[model samples]
Target: MLSAVSRALLGALMLSVAAVAAQAQDFPNRPITIVLPYPPGASTEQVARMIQPVMQERLKQPVVIENKPGGNGSIGTLAVARSAPDGHTILLTTNALMTIVPHVQTMPFDPLKDFVPLTTAIRGILGIAVNPNVPAKNVAEFVAYAKANPKKVHFGTAGIGSPQHMAGLLLNREAGIDLVHVPYKGGGPAVNDAMGGHIQAVIATVSSVIGQHKSGLLRIIGIGEKERFAGQPDIQAIAETVPGFEATSWLAFYAPAGTPKAAVDVLNRELVFALNTPEVKQKLFDLGLPVVADKPEELDRRTRSDLKLWGDIAREMNVRAE
Candidate 1:
């Protein structure tokens, strides 16, 4: 016993709910695209490619990887942020986009509000490597050398305000050193300069310089992770010397903010399943990225925490992208 208008409103609401449920059931009816906000050879891109097949199989749709590198990862990230909130287009990017860049540069979208956290796909530790000519074999010796030399020691990073740059800033504050930062176009150039002895030190990912370290071209002075990386147990964690030093870079999956909760849940389930597969885990581990199939809330918490951490560091260091 309801008025005509009230009955019509109820019917319309029911229809809307049914439509959303149907859409969720047929989630990803079209091919899904994962936008990598960095160049192709980056660790994020590599990890995306590795997970692509498994995700496709799980979702029953082709998963495409699209690279759109520019503006320190903001260009492509903004594209994903502006995409339809239908789960068809998603972003697979690093913490730098949400945690570091926004603090240093003006972004088109709000990092916290424009996207929904899906999962943290993988995490990799940074390495404190030095040119072989430097007389530092450990974190203590390296810190001592840097302190003794002051601004004479140059530390090369991927770019200004990058995670590597933040790591350098943290190192200076925690270890009490005055090493100068030399910004490079990317980690490749920075690593190359360190290898060629153009720079005394470089903070880079383990995958970027592990081969060189093994070949004796460069020496890994310390690991920037709280615990030792499983792939390289012999390398000691920098925290042992610096007392609570830990900096890591991670790649995470996110969808547009208004994507249906059902769609988000499906994507998270498929992604977590893919990450837990033995072969996928093995491949990621081989590449120095440990699989971290954390729940959505976990990633969200981490992202928010890192945003504050890097924001404070940026203000203190007066870091801005060049």
Candidate 2:
């Protein structure tokens, strides 16, 4: 008893539903490429490589890591954004690039709208370290020293608008001290400069500075995370001295928006399984990214939470990439 027009629309809707089911059933019909938007050999890249084999085995597809490093992780991110949402292509990215930097830089694709998070598998920890030559031993002591020396106490970060930069700026604003910031091409170079005494302090990954901290080359005065890292319990959290302080970054997997929910669920299952693998878990810890492996919904919730937190920090602090 339906009208002809209504019958045609119903048929189209049924066909669309069937097509989605078929697509999900045939997911990863070919190879799966994880686009890493950072340079090779960085922790982000290392994480992708570490999980590649496990995912390949579980998904029964050739999982390849395509490095598309540039524009502070935007060039490759955009490429994935524009890719087919058939679950064949995914982006392995961070909170800094997704939530923090987006507030300051105009992007070709909307981060919050263009991607669907699969899961958050790991998080990066940041630390504040100073040259052994610096007299400060703890964050409180360091703040006092910075207040006395003013711009004389220079701090280096991986780059402008990076998580390290955010951490440094928060310290400056809260402690009411002027710690001159020197941006570097990478965290390694920033930490190296601090080690050589070219800069008084450097904000970088806890993993990057841990060896030097143990070697007596530099001292980790405080950790940017709310609590101390499990591996390094001796280091003090910055919040111990500066109330409510935390600057951390998490790496999550995402597919272009409109990717089928079934495909996303499949990818999330495999991604979480890969991360929890004993070998992958130990390596990630060694690399200084503690395993999170949260659900897709949790990843989405965390992203929204960080957008509000870091967005406020970036705006109030006037942090910008350009």
**Per-residue lDDT of candidate 2, residues 184-273 (tens digit):** 988889988999999999998888889999999999988888888887889999999998888887889999999999999999989989
Name the regions of candidate 1 deviating beyond 4 angstroms.
Answer: none
Highest lDDT against the true fold, candidate: 1
How displaced is residue 291 in candidate 1, in Å?
0.9
Q: Mind sharing the TM-score for model 2?
A: 0.96
lDDT at 3 for candidate 1?
A: 98
The whole-model lDDT of each prediction reads 0.90, 0.89
Model 2 segments beyond 4 Å from truth?
none
- Candidate 1 has its poorest 10 consecutive residues by lDDT at 42-51
Q: How many clashes show up per model?
A: 0, 0
